[model samples]
Target: MRKKIIEFKNFNFKYRVQAEPTLKDINLTIYEGEKVLIVGPSGSGKSTLAHCLNGLVPFYYRGDMSGELKINEQDIRTKNIFELSKIVGTVLQDPDSQFIGLTVGEDIAFKLENYCVEQKKMKEKVEKSARLVDIDEELQSSPYRLSGGQKQRVTLAGVTVDDVKVLLFDEPLASLDPATGKGAMELIDNIQKQDNKTVVIIEHRLEDVLHCDVDRIVVMDNGCIICDTTPDELLSSNKLGVVGVREPLYITALRYAGCDINPEMSPKSVKTLNIENCKSKVKEWFEITTISEKQKKCDTILELQDVSFSYSQEKQILKDVSFKINKGDMVSIVGRNGAGKSTVSKLICGFYKPTSGKILFDGKDIETESIKSRSEKIGFVMQNPNQMISKTKVFDEVAFGLKIRGVDENQITERVHNVLKTCGLYGHRNWPISALSFGQKKRVTIAAILVLNPEVIILDEPTAGQDFKHYTEIMEFLIDLNKKGVTVIMVTHDMHLMLEYTNNVIVLSNGEKIADDSATNILTNNEIIQKANLKETSLHELAKKCNIDNSIEFVNKFIDYDRRVR
Candidate 1:
């Protein structure tokens, strides 16, 4: 019989600041060598459960707890944080936050050093771990200079070097590009197979996590586990959407085509999914779901002419980059991490002036205008909400922009309330910022920018840490604003968002513009997808396998149909 690695019985926990329990009457069991994926909407107690397992709940968070929880058959209440670390190792969403050493080698050796391992043995372990993660050549490189994927590998090396029996990944793919995310998942799969370790992954990107072989999937909502089942069973059921979790795109597409897939038909990854059994159903659905083509707009609202910028002479971030964004356009800037996607947004927003080139807003040179003047016409929402939020109360934060512009008090009240309602934060207008969840704080920052009534809004990874429900809510609001003639430009690594929402896509590679075309065209081109380090959607591959004519066109039209129906 397999050993039970972790167990929870009638577990309940309430934060000191909240009135209700964050985790309610939880009962769960995880066995050795089992890979489990935990998914839920924001504030659904998924992270809280992870905290409980890692000894952060009562030890660091100071929460009121009741019930029994065990790790390796030992009561967690009897163990402190330091003791828990020996058995359960946690790798956080932001790998940089977990890094303690300046270089890759040092980072991997940190925990071993703490344990007073011999110098020769510590060096051997660090080198072995680095090799496992395929980063042996980067051992001497600084962690700060590594890409998102490399930094994550360094963190993984550090966690695994200590011979921990259990591993916890807290949204490992949250900040990575699609290709890098796939690599990370594959690395985890290899590690699990080699070590036979008990692994648990907490994430909102269900589709991405499904790329690996998950033994079971646990769905949470409102601090309760609504469903616990295998991937096939969960995908076959209608419970995912009901609980505000997003189902995989191919699965969603099958259902949208009016086909009831087999309950036992679960494929490990989208790339390897066999759709031969459902070809007829898919063909019928494709024939019915047709959409008309949209006409292109030509009014240029923002233009970058031969722009070049550099933090120092040693490195040039953008070189002779040029592009024009039309008014009312929903444009997406996409590329791999460190490919200069966010830099383009910053240059447009006047956060960094180009060393040589011109940025024009409404045919006027924005470089000549004051930062305050430029901000009035263009608003930039940062990637991190905590960095943007300044006011204690949500109401004041949203209303501050208008008050600074010398707007009347009555008008400020009217504008603030309307934007808050649009962003779905009206009910919590008077609540303190500290009381809000990460997703809620994100809405507050966007609401603050919306009240300013800018012509164009630039968002950097706006939906990075958001759940599917909140993501849809925020995007729908942006779509409504776009219809009213506000330009939306998103810097993102999410292919689904780009294909479903944006009309145009700008491909950037090493701070240079590679392609400017329709979202479908850019994604469907294998050469461009490879050159830009973008992942091809499974829907596109499925269309080809079904022998469907005009596969790209079919995928594009289906996305349009899906967007309209939603």
Candidate 2:
């Protein structure tokens, strides 16, 4: 029998800042060499459990706790975090929050230096670990200058350099593109297989980890384990979906079609699942009506002509980018990390002046306008929710933008309340910002911008860590706003969002505009998919396997049927 690496007995904890317990009576056992996933909505004690495993729960977090927590057959209460660090290495959810070194090389060696390793051996170990995570080439590069994907790699390398036997990842895939996230999972699998390491991954994105060869998945809610089962069983059961756990879109579609997902009747393998049936159901659910000729012929809102931008004299980030966003059009900008998707948003918001060519808003060049001046025309919601939040109360946060624009108190209150309810935050209007979860904060930031009712609304990574329920709500709200004559531009890596919500797609590669077309066209073009670091949707993949060449018809049928059944 494998060793029991982590054991929690009747454990309960409450943060010093709060009166209620975040975790309650958690009983769990993590065996050695087991890859366990702890999942739930934000603020569900997933991170709290991770902190407990790493000895940060009662130490750094200053929380009241009762009962026993053990790691590596040792009680964590008996040791400080520094002593427990030798047993478990943690890669935080936010890479930027844990960076301790100026360069990648130095950061990897930072942990080793604490042990007083000889300089020569330290160099060899640092190089080996850097190569392990594929960041060797970035050894001397400043960590601050690295892209989101590269920053994630640096954090992974930093955690593993100490040769810790237990590895804990707190949403490591949050900032990565899908391709990068998949690669990271493969690397993790390889490491566990070769080294027999115990891996505990905390993530809300279930699709990325579904195929990873994990031994067990422990689902958490309200600081307690709700479900503990294998990946195959978890995927086959609809219980997770009922509780709002965001399973893969394919699985969700299958469940909607009245397909029994039991061990014997479940689609079983993603490869073996009849994708045509699933797509037929998805199309039925979507009820995708063709755009009216008049709607398609709407007037242009913004035009980009021969726009080019370069960060340095030798390195150009964007080259000759050109596109047009029509009035009331919901457009998605998608690409790999660091592909200049965010740069296009900045240019649209007047944060950066294009090196050449013109960006015509209402057919007039606004290159000279400041970000503040352009706020009247465009509303920009940043990627990090923490950066956008400033006021203490939710109502005040949403009203700040309107107040700054010289709106009266009555108008501010009315607009704020309306936008709050639209974003599903009206219930928490009087609540302090500190009381909300990460997902709630995201909605708050969006609500603040949405209340402004700008001509064009631009959101950067609007649904990065949101759950399916929240994703649907946000997209539905945005769709309503678009119908009300607001142009929506979203910078996202979520393929599902692009396919199910947006009307147009813009693919970027190395900061260049590679393809601009409908979502259907982009999905079918293999070359564009490769360039933009995306794969065919699960529905598309399944359709090909079932020999359905007409994806449009398949999708329409699938969505229609799914809707009728629902």
Candidate 3:
């Protein structure tokens, strides 16, 4: 039997500022050399549990604690963050915030320098760790200059340099594109195998994390551990949907096809998870499921023609990107991290002047329009909520957009109230923005834009790092808004959202437009999926294995059926 490295018994924790306990009566034990996955929705206390392990909960967070929490047989309450830092290293979800040095080499070596390590040894260790994470080549480059995936590697190298016994990854996939995220998972797995280290991952992206094998998966909700079991046992059960954590879409599809997943039937990869009656049941389900025809696009509410952009003369951000978004169409703009997906939206919002191109809103060129004027018709919610949130209080922040537009107090209050309620943020309406979690802050920013009621709303990575429940609420609200004649454009890295919610997708690669077609059409094309750094829905793979000629229609029909059943 492996040694016990982390143990939490009857543990409860409440932040100094929070009204109630964030973690309640939790009991979990992770053995040394074990890879455990902790999963939950936003505010579920998974991140809090991770903090407790890394000595951030009681130390940095200044939380009230009860019960016993021990790491390596030492009580955490007795140790400061520095003591625990040597035992467990943590890679936070946001790499930008984790950086502490001007360049990659300095950032990775910051901790060693603090410990007064010899310069020669520190250099050797930093280079070795960076090489392990495949980030050694960028040692002298500014950390901020690298792409999201590269930044992730730098952070990973930073943690490994200390050679901590246990590695804790909190939402590691939150920053990378799907293909890059897969590579990251493989890298972490390889390091663990090489060192025999204990690995604990806290993430909402369950399917992606499952790319590597895990010994156990611990599910949490409402500040409690709802289930602690192996992957086979958990996937075979319906607990994922009940706890509001997203199940692998392929698993969900299997259940929808009337073929329940059993313990023996479950596998880490969708390619190997074949059910006894899967083919027959799925084909029958497909036969009976009728996909509704797509509604005709009403008018050209927003159009970008021959758009080209560059920050410097030598580098191109977007090149000759042309696409038309109709009034009330829910569209997605997707690509890799540095593929300029967000830049396209910024140009549409008049944040950047195109090097040479045309942008028209309602049949007129928007070249002369001010950003403030463009925002009146089109609202943009940035990928990072912190970038947009200004007011300290929640209500003030949401109402700021409306008030500046000279709306009356009564109307502002009513509008803000409705938007907050729609966003599942009504309860946090009076709370300080700082007190909220990262995901909650995201909701507030969306609420701020939603309260203004723009004709077109463009959200960049809107559902990134959000829990499944909130993702559903926010996307459903967007759908409702679309039904009521609001056009929605999402710049996202989430493949599930792209396929399930958006009808049309615009693919970009190397600053050039690659494919502009229906989401189903684009997703089924392996060439486009690989080129865009996007992953194909398992539904597509299932169709091909089942000998279905048209994977596009299979994906489309299954999505329609899944939405109806849900």
| Candidate 1 residue runs with Cα over 4 Å from true position | 271-274
How high a TM-score does candidate 1 get?
A: 0.95
lDDT of 3 at 560: 89
Off by over 4 Å in 2: 265-269, 272-297, 424-438, 556-566
Total clashes for model 2: 14
Ranking of models by TM-score: 3, 1, 2
Backbone-clash count (model 3): 0
Candidate 3 ranges beyond 4 A from true positions: none
* lDDT scores of the candidates, listed in order: 0.88, 0.81, 0.89
lDDT of 1 by residue, 376-455 (tens): 88899987788898899999999998888899999999999998887778889999998786668888998899888789
TM-score, every prediction: 0.95, 0.92, 0.98
What lDDT score is found at residue 337 in candidate 2?
A: 88
RMSD of each: 1.9, 3.1, 1.2
Query: Deviation in angstroms for 316 in model 2?
Result: 0.7
Root-mean-square deviation of Cα positions for candidate 3 versus the true structure, in angstroms: 1.2
User: For candidate 3, what is the TM-score?
Assistant: 0.98
Residues 1-566, candidate 3: write the lDDT tens digits. 67999999999999887789999999999998899999988888888898899988888899789999989999987788998998999898889999999999999999899899999999999999999999999999999999999999999889889899999998999878888888889998999999998999998899999988989999998999999999989998988889899998878877787886787876556866765567888887777889987678869888899999999989989889898999999999998889999898999899999999899999999999999999999999998999999999999999999888899999998999898998889988899899888888889999999888899999998998898999999999999999999999999888889888998898999999899898888877889989989887788887776666777888888888878877
Q: Give the candidate order by descending lDDT.
A: 3, 1, 2
